[model samples]
Target: MDERSQFLADAAAQRKERELNRVQTETTLKLQALARGYLARKKFVSAVRSTTSEKFSAFVDLEKSEKVLLSNDEVLKWSRLFLRILRLPDDNEVLALLVPDTSYFHWTPSRVISDIISTIPQSLMYISGNRVTENSLFLASNEHKPLISGQALNALFSILFKSVKNDENLLPIFISHVLTCPAIVVHLNKANLDNFLNSELFDRCLTYLRSSPELVESIEPQKTINLLGNVIHLGYLDEETVKNRIVDWTWVIGLVMAQCTEFAVRPGEQSSHNHWHPIFGHYRLPIDPKLWKKLGGGSSSEPTHTAELEKDIPPTLAAIVCQLYMTALSTMTNMKNEIIAGICREDRTLRQLWSYLVRWGNQGRYVSSSSTAPSPLNAALSLMSCPQSLHAAPLMLFADAAAIVISILDEEELYERAVPFALEELVHIARFCNYFCFRAVWTGYVDDRSSDHGLFASIHQLCMVLHVRDSRRSFVNDPKFWLAPDVKSSILMGEFEKKTPRGVLLMRRMSHLVSLKERMLLFRKFVSADKNSNESSATLITGLDEAGIDQDGVFKEFLELTIKKVFDPALNLFHSTAAGVLYPSATSSVHEDHLALFQFVGRILAKAVYEGIVVDVQLAPVLLAAVRFFIQILLDFVVCN
Candidate 1:
């Protein structure tokens, strides 16, 4: 017996040593990861400050040293470390390193290049002036030019095409960057431009942008507009070659519409007096008489011939402007149908395009005061009537789009129109909360936490709108509506003296109910309910009282349904254990399991009681049943031992 005991003790000690080693190894890895992250961030910040060639060389040396210090496998473990490294000064050498190759263990080349492009500063891409002129619109000043030169850019593009030429995913980021940099476009030699245009790159990029309207917004608005002007100028200068080289004209048309919406100036409104003519005539090309006629200018107007116009603005450029204006008008007329079709066909693009149009229209003079002008709000709201279109849309997308429309209506002071839509959409989202939660957990499309939080926030905002508009009574009459009674009281009693939405209150109520249901289950299986029986019973009654369950049938029904779903199964698990069916051992394993259950139940009950969700007298039976189960488990353990 003594030798047997000694052997068991030796085995236990070996197992404990193994566990300790495992824990130590895990801790070491985590510490190393943290240290690597710190070093990466430090190196990147230092590199960004290195503006001169000598300093940039030093930065490159530091990166090489880091590579030597850490193995490729170690670096791969630090996923976010590479992202920080891309924020370094935008040098071609550094940019080239970011392009994915076989050396990179984890990330693909396309992902690295996309990150590099996205890290380009917004200030670098956008410029501002008191007035919008050709000089202000395009990056004419040396200060506005990115650190990347024309030759370096061409090399980078060549490398990108050669490395990942067929990567459609990387094309949007590439196209957006190219469209935003006027300096790059203007400085590129004809050979490079011809090469890019001739390749399938341009066609693929345009096709991607059209199918994914959201990616269009990713391009800097000002720079893209200027790019449109440049492209049009090029097309006018070499009509036949430009037409053959260009992949699609609709992409060009889309660019024009985006620019017109952003600038909020119609072609005629800005160019009626030929203020843009001087800029175009600078290229010394002959002006087309047909182009002047299209711009609402008479054939007898001054500068009748190309020679009479300013030499600085080319006639070819002027003709391009005229064509762009005509295209903008045609696009504006059809934008409503196009946006609707885009949303229906691709749900992900819904908010991206909608927000760009809505924000531009709101901030600028895009919406005319004339009754004849189309209302973007009316056009967007029409989507709400088509439930089929939104059925498969992500919860976050649907909620955000609805919020934008409501905000626009509120800004326009169209209160009467906002009421029905707000109420209906709020109810629609509430019904889908469970579906969203389920989808987020089981599928990868929706983020588990943010989507639910965002949906609830949207719900609260709409509820507040209805409450303040004195329309809560209508919502209360609807069986589908779900807001706490206390929230209604706060709204009616004017307890919410500020303009706060009752959504916060509603969310709190829901959170409390969920906690109560979870705690009830925990209590039945693990806790010694007799230890705090009186306290638990009192807390349940208080929660029910606060929820106004006595007076509110809907709230009462919700609570009962939740209890049935969560508490009953937990009680069944406890009953089996108490009946000695699941108590296969009276060893430390059984005791440890019971102890863990007790601790879990205790923590939840404490929180529920504190939150006032455990205060209903109707929960007395459930609480007593838990106490009895706890006693039964203790008795079985003692007998088995």
Candidate 2:
């Protein structure tokens, strides 16, 4: 054959190989799903007659029943109830059915259903209770026990787990119930616990874990969190974990955090979100979630220690683990922060030491990714989540994150450094005064639950922080940043009392920066839309905040100065390039508070260029010149670009 022909054939062969590999993978995943359905405790088989269609084929099992329970018209679609059967059993001879509560991504489990049916040529039974609603099954029979023995069940669950790591909810209970063995709730040491990932050790732990299953509607959030924390702690977390688990970790960590978050909110807790329909018109996990903002009220009660964790684990490492959770974790930031602080005491400069956890200096973007991470956010409310131990360094970490942003803006690489983070995260965090020292003279207290804001609490924080941070403290000297309102009379301080002007400004800056920073988070929802476009956003706007500044004369004057000094032209210019990345809600952060937005930036620029560090006296003029120069270059580049 000619060389070109041979090359073409080889290419075709490679393509075929990849397709085959994908099909096989999908087949394996689907079988596991079917197996899980077959093993579910409540699953009942029905025999039906004359069922012949592509989705299902009638199988006659006359031994159990003479009549066919399923027929062609009665083909089954076991989607909803099947979710309860979380894992696939090891026995291949076990015929199965499945119904999954739809997930956002097909990759998780449901993605491969088609592959399984196409390859295995099996029945996709439509189930309603034990009856076959859609497909007629000719066979109907099941034993109380699976054919597999104890060892078989473990190996079966283990192999299925290797393919699917995150779906433990229904499986844990099933394993516990089916095995008639209580799950290993806790072990004595890390060695037996499998902290470091030695497969044999981990296998032992998993075997033990699979055995014990004392089920309860979440009773203790901390108690469950401690037991889980130990398993994660035993693993030697480093570059390898990151490299190997990027795709898997997204689900594993997501599931782990989700479970913890559930415990955090417990069933009836009044959540800080509007979506939570408080059962008795109250709350869930911890004292109505509606009151989450107030629950950890006094300053001293931060959730820092976990009884299950090895106390000897370096505080720095503990801090990194906790700080990664800085954005939100159900409990107020301080409660989380205190835990991190305890760990950070062991090592002060953990950020510098831990490069994997953070992005810095050059590999940064002007906008966060268009996609928002939901697991981390959802876990925020679930009491079952592993909450961050707010050790000391997060405060410092926030400072460092803020400093990096400030320095970059001065140097004109602000877009590069802050784009990836969407500055909104830092700004939202500023209200607490953990990262930046600045604050507005005005009180920055926003109502909690600001509308079931998913991960967007970070966004809400930005708008409110920037809205109030610029005025002199005397403006709101009625109290400070951390001050709790006293309906009856006067108030008192926690940790650091009597807030400062500088503190207020710094707080607001993050508020503003976070808004600009979060522009990139809206893209995921945009992409998630189906081609039919029924559920997508009506508009690209992240959010829109109607002007909430009802103050009369005083705030009006402030608005003018802000527009002239900050908001107009400059914000508008960046918005043109960035608006695509934001949803209306995110954009409304600025729209909500015009004066605060402008003044907050104006003050910071003024201070840095004039009062604070003087990177360049002609910073303003230099910026203008850079803009003009960029315009000229862009004009030329536009022709080609």
Which candidate leads in TM-score?
2
lDDT of 1 by residue, 454-558 (tens): 233443343333332223134335432433322333342242234233323323223221233443554453344544654643434434443454564554465
Each prediction's TM-score versus the true structure: 0.24, 0.24
lDDT tens per residue, model 2, 412-499: 2222354323334433333433221221122232222222232223333333433333221121232333332221111111111234
Model 1 steric clash total: 20
Per-candidate clashes come to 20, 114
Model 1: lowest-lDDT 10 consecutive positions: 297-306
Evaluate candidate 2 by giving its C-alpha RMSD to the native, one decimal.
29.1
